[model samples]
Target chain A: MEKSSVLTVLSALAHDTRLDVFRLLVRAGPEGMTAGSLAATLDIRSNTLSNNLVILSAAGLVRSAREGRAIRYFARMEQMRDLLGFLMEDCCGGQPELCQPVLDQITCPC
Target chain B: MEKSSVLTVLSALAHDTRLDVFRLLVRAGPEGMTAGSLAATLDIRSNTLSNNLVILSAAGLVRSAREGRAIRYFARMEQMRDLLGFLMEDCCGGQPELCQPVLDQITCPC
Candidate 1:
């Protein structure tokens, strides 16, 4: 990803509410969750949730699909992956050992 | 890492100049680069570099140590690891396969 894209993703996630929302959506899985559910679960106002979702969508971190009368939002795992890749792009500078621990931490044992 | 720390780190890196500076520091590795050199290399004014460095330092993303009359800044790899771990903490939610691609991209082949 380009620097500007990375910046956008980072800025989008920098907020406490947005990060929590993104994590919640990630845990919710492919089926995703509705704005109402997210607002209730996060104990946030609808307008606040709406604003955060807009920022996340704009950054490509979240996507919405209209399902019935509700819009379901799913975490865009690919975008998260891209942001992580950009963050670590210059890591270790060809020395794998330097960043091995970081890699180890990110990898799921399961 | 706490949510606040992640926010701080994310906000610190959200800017183009700061991200560029951090990446430069990362590539410079443990030995680090002096403030004077960073200013020259990034073509940023000393005040601007100083402000950016302060933000990076406050976020614990970079560390500076006095070297002669100058300060040399180095990327804090451990902190970067913490930030990445926090980001991926909820990823895949026990379904490692879902996040395997992200892991693959971040791991250095070298």
Candidate 2:
């Protein structure tokens, strides 16, 4: 990811509620959760959750897919990978070993 | 890596200049670089760089040490590791393999 894209993603995660929501979604994995369910779980109002989700979606951290009457939100692993890569890009001053441990973590199942 | 600490660190990184400076510091590693040198390299005024450094220091992302007349700044690797761990905590829902790649990267040589 470019610097701008990284900034966008980080900004989306800068807030308390949004960060909580995003972390939960990351745990939820690709299957995601319904908007209403997320709201209920977070103890947040639907409107507030919708607004937070919009911000996250805009930042490419989370995506929403309409499933009948409910909209499910899932963390975009690719975008997240891009984010981790951006921050780690050029890490260790050209010595990949310095960053090998972090790479060992944060993998995509697919 | 608590929520509030994460917010503080992320807020410090939210701005363009601060982000650039922090990234540079991270690249510089434990030895770090002098304040004046960093300002010169970034083409940012010393005062502006100083202010940004204060924010970063306050957020615990970087630490400053006096070397003669100038203070050299180093990325707080422990704090960074904490930040990463906080974000990745509970990742993959007990399946650590899911985060192995990222862990493979971002390690300390020590």
Candidate 3:
């Protein structure tokens, strides 16, 4: 990913509310959650949730699909992967072992 | 890492200049770079670099040590690891395969 893209994703997630929303959506998985449910679960105003979702969508961190009268939002896992890859691109200066701990932490055991 | 620390790190890196400086310091490794050299290399003003470094240090993304008359700064790899871990904590929710691609990319094969 380019620097600007990384910057956008970082900025989108830098906020407390957005980060919580993203994590909630990540846990919700591809099935996603309706914006109304998300707003209720997060205890955020509809307008505030709408604004955060817009920022996240613009950053390619989230995607929305219209289902019935509701809009369901899914966390874009690929984008998160790309951002992580960009951050670790030059890590350890070609010495992968130096980053083993990081690898261990991010590698899901389940 | 806590949400606040992650926010601080993200906010610190959201900027173009600070991101460049962080990536540069990451590539520079533990040997680090002097403030003067970092300023010249990035073509940034001393005060600007100083301010950025202070922000980075406060966010625990960078560490500085007095070397002679210069303060050499190194990227705090552990903190980066923690931040990445925090972001990926709920990824795939018990389905590692869903996040395998993310793992492969960040694994750092040398």
lDDT of 1 by residue, A1-110 (tens): 88888999999998999999998888777768999999999999999999999999999999999889989998887787667766776566546566656444444322
Which residue runs of candidate 3 sit more than 4 Å off their true CA positions?
Answer: A94-110, B94-110
* lDDT measured at residue A17 in model 2 versus the true structure, 0 to 100: 93
Backbone atom clashes (below 3 Å) for every candidate: 0, 27, 0
Ranking by DockQ: 2, 3, 1
Model 3 root-mean-square deviation: 3.6
- Chain B TM-score of model 2, please? 0.83
Best by lDDT: 3
Clashing pairs in 1: none
Each model's C-alpha lDDT?
0.82, 0.80, 0.83
Chain A TM-scores, candidates in order: 0.84, 0.85, 0.85
Two-chain complex of model 1, DockQ on C-alpha atoms against the true structure: 0.41
Q: What is the per-residue lDDT of model 1 for residues B4-56, given as tens digits with 9 covering 90 to 100?
A: 99999999999999999999887777678899999999999999999999999
lDDT: worst 10-residue window of model 3 chain B: B101-110
Q: Quality of candidate 3's docking, in CAPRI categories?
A: acceptable
TM-score of each: 0.86, 0.88, 0.87
Q: For this target, which candidate reaches the highest TM-score against the unseen true structure?
A: 2
Taken in order, the candidates have interface RMSDs of 5.5, 2.9, 5.2
Clashing pairs in 3: none
